[model samples]
Every structure is written in C-alpha cells, then in structure tokens.
Target: MPRERELILGGQRSGKSRRAEQRAADWLALDPAHRAVLIATATAHDEEMRERIARHRADRAQRVPGLVTVEEAVRLGPALARHSEPGTLVLIDCLTLWLTNLLMPAESGSASPALAETAHAGLLHALHGARGPVLLVSNEIGLGVIPMGREARAFVDALGRLNQAVAGACDRVTLMAAGLPLRLKEPG
Candidate 1:
C-alpha cells in the first residue's frame, strides 16, 4: 500500500487545480523518473468548454514538461485503477466535472441515482486501493446560496457528499484560493 492520497477543493477561479498541479510537480521533482499521470475530467461539451480544456492541456504541457495526460470524461475509477502503481503520481484535475458526468443524463433522461451510486462506489474503491500518490482536485460548491432547481440541488448535494467522502480517505487535504493553499489536513 503506497502512502499517497490528497484532495484540493475551492471555488471557481480559485486556482485549485493549479495548486494541485504545482504540488504534484513538486512531488515529481523530488523523483524525476516517477511517472506523471494526469487524469483530466473535463468534457468538451461546447466550444467554450473545448477551448478551456485545450488551454488547460497546453498549460499542463508547459508547466510539467513531460506529463502523461489521460482524458476520462465519465469512467474515471476504471482509468485510475488501471494506471495507478508505485513510483507514479496521479493528478486528477477537477472532480466536479467528473461528478457531473457521473450524475448527469446521457441524452435527455433524468439523472439516475443508481448509476451515481455505482460511480461513487467505484471512485472510492479506486482511491482507497491506489498504489501510489493520488491528488484529486474538486470544486467547493457549498459556499453559495441554495440552487433554484431540483437537478441542480441534487447535483450539489451529491458533489458535497463525494467531496467529504474523498477527503475523509485522503492523507492530506488543502483548500486553494487565489492560488494560495490553506491546509486543511496534513500528514503526521
């Protein structure tokens, strides 16, 4: 069992993902030969999102010179389970999108609780069973007013629950804001 599980959470534009990436890069710097596993959760749903994803990819390339990025829009647990190993640092960029993907409908149908439950179980299993460092980035959506719709409320509720579940299993947890890290949990 490798000792590496971290969580970073913050509001939008809070530089949470950047902070997570920087920490991952720093960890890799200590051991240059360690494999860099970047699990991207963003989906290219629209032109704006596609551009944002593209920019994020470019930034990752520039920041971490030799990074391996794996784009898994929905099934992240399987991907993480497959690539996680000793001497590897897996950095997952934004769990919010992944949660959305897991909770949202494929076409126009209603969001299925059974599917979300399965995805949640898979993610937790992967995180707890990982063999190397796993840094997960996610948004803190509970800082705002109550949502105006049932779906939005359900999504927020699910995300908050998921964040808590991951954080509970992490060795260290940090909240980023304006590119600064506020340590929530630190290794003993």
Candidate 2:
C-alpha cells in the first residue's frame, strides 16, 4: 500500500499541531509496532520559546505516550530519510520555522539563497519518497496583510511556496480554523 502524506495548515493557535498529533496517534493505534516520530523544528532561542517547547513535550507525553521526538531545525531531509519507514509515522511539527532558520542571515548579514534552495529541494524530495505516513504542519501566512519589511515579506513568500509544494506532494491537505479541519485535498 502507498504511504499516506498529509499537510495541515492553519494560523497561529489554530490547532494545526494538535490535529497532526491526533492523526499520528490514530496511525500508531493501527498496529502494536507502529511507531510515531515528531520532527520538531522549533528552536528554544528565548524563554517563551523554551516554555512553549516544554509544554508541547508534556502534552505529547500525556496525549500521545508512544510518540517519540526528533529535533531537526535545519537538516529536515536527512532526519526524515532516517525516521520514515514502513509501520512508522513521522509528524513534522512545523515548516515555517524551518524556512525561517534557512533564511536567517549569517554573520556577514546576508542570506544564502543557494543554501535555502538546496535544503528546500532536499526536503521536498524526501517527502515525496517517504516510505511511511508523514504529517507536516505549517502556518498559513498568506491570508494576512502585506508586511512592511522586506525580510518579512520574503519569509512569507518562501513559506507560501513551500506550503504549495508540500500540498502538491501530500495525498491529503487540511486547513484548520477554530480547531476544525476543512479538507482541501483527499487521497484518491
């Protein structure tokens, strides 16, 4: 059977991550040996972020006890390749943060376009050929008003493109609003 690939998109606090976790749990429940892995991309660069990460960990432990976590802030393609296997489910907590990490300026104060492109290509390739169920979560930033800053605008554009590419690769695509999921794409 072909693997299931899903993309969950939503605004902040719209329950995208929660939805992904629920789907992962459901997939894991199908078989005793089915394993769930969360590929977390968020970094604890601030106290608030650290707290948020901690809360997520606690929630996952309580809500999805069997799910394991893998922290991959940049090299998501390699991580996915290593974890995605038959009878395993991988949930990428987010793609927006991962894009941000790729776009961040180096000490020279310039973003490397080649590096970002390569990483993006690698991730898409991995997702397209994954051997197990994969759930990817990403913020829907295109609905908002235009940003004034150039960097912010670039980030938004990159995220929009990334989401579109992932959605194309996914067998299912869902938009979350008010904790409700509206299916955009259904598996054939």
Maximum-lDDT candidate: 2
Residue 114, model 1: lDDT of: 86
CA displacement after TM-score superposition, residue 111 of candidate 1 (Å): 1.4
| Per-residue accuracy of model 1 over 1-188 as CA lDDT, tens digit each | 14579999999999887787787778778876777789998877679988988898898889987678999987888998998999888888879988887778555556677887898889899999998999999999999999999889989999999999999999999998887889999887
Shift of residue 86 alpha carbon in model 2, Å: 0.3
Candidate 1 lDDT trough over 10 residues, lowest sum: 103-112
Error of 1 at 150 (Å): 1.1
Clashing residue pairs in candidate 1 are none
**Candidate 1: where is the Cα deviation over 4 Å?**
106-109
Model 2 / residue 131 / CA error / Å: 0.6
Considering only N, C-alpha and C atoms within 3 Å, which residue pairs clash in candidate 2? none
